[model samples]
Target: MLYLKSIGTPLVLVMALFALGGCEQAEKSAQQMLNQAAESAKQAIDKTNEAAQQALSEATGSEKTDKEDSKDADGQKI
Candidate 1:
């Protein structure tokens, strides 16, 4: 139709410009989100390792007392 012919070209150009800007902004936002997620994941892993290490150290320390256990007449240890 003649109506489409007159407006189609300009609409296409405007749409193209808006799409390009939108894509650029989307890419920047995605990059920022990825960076934040990675940093948070790394911090969480570090904290978990620290906690595990602490728990293991504590468990090991309690399991084997620094002093040797004394034996009784029945060969039992207190």
Candidate 2:
């Protein structure tokens, strides 16, 4: 009984240490994954904004051309 008691405490401590180490590694991995997801979301938002601006510019340009076509050389409306 004395021998078992002496060894059991050390064994329990080693197992606890291993468990804590594993938990720390898992936390780091989860954080890395979250960072990657956020970056991807930012890139998508940037692309969407660029496309919206391009569409707006094209629409504005077409409106100007249409107005010019409706006017005569003297700047009067046909």
TM-score of each: 0.55, 0.68
What would the per-residue lDDT of candidate 2 be over residues 1-78, giving only the tens digit for each residue? 334234354445445555677677656655565566567668889999999999999999999999999999999999
Model 2's lDDT to the true fold?
0.71
What's the C-alpha lDDT at position 12 in model 1?
A: 54
Clashing residue pairs, backbone N/CA/C < 3 A, model 2: none
Query: lDDT (CA) for every model shown?
Result: 0.64, 0.71
Clashes of each: 0, 0
Candidate 1 error regions (>4 Å) = 1-22, 66-78
Residue 27 CA error for candidate 1 (Å)?
0.5
Model 1, TM vs. native: 0.55
> Tens-digit lDDT track for model 1 on 1-78?
334234354455445555777677656665565566567668889999999999999988876653334655675776
Q: What is the lDDT of residue 62 in candidate 2?
A: 100
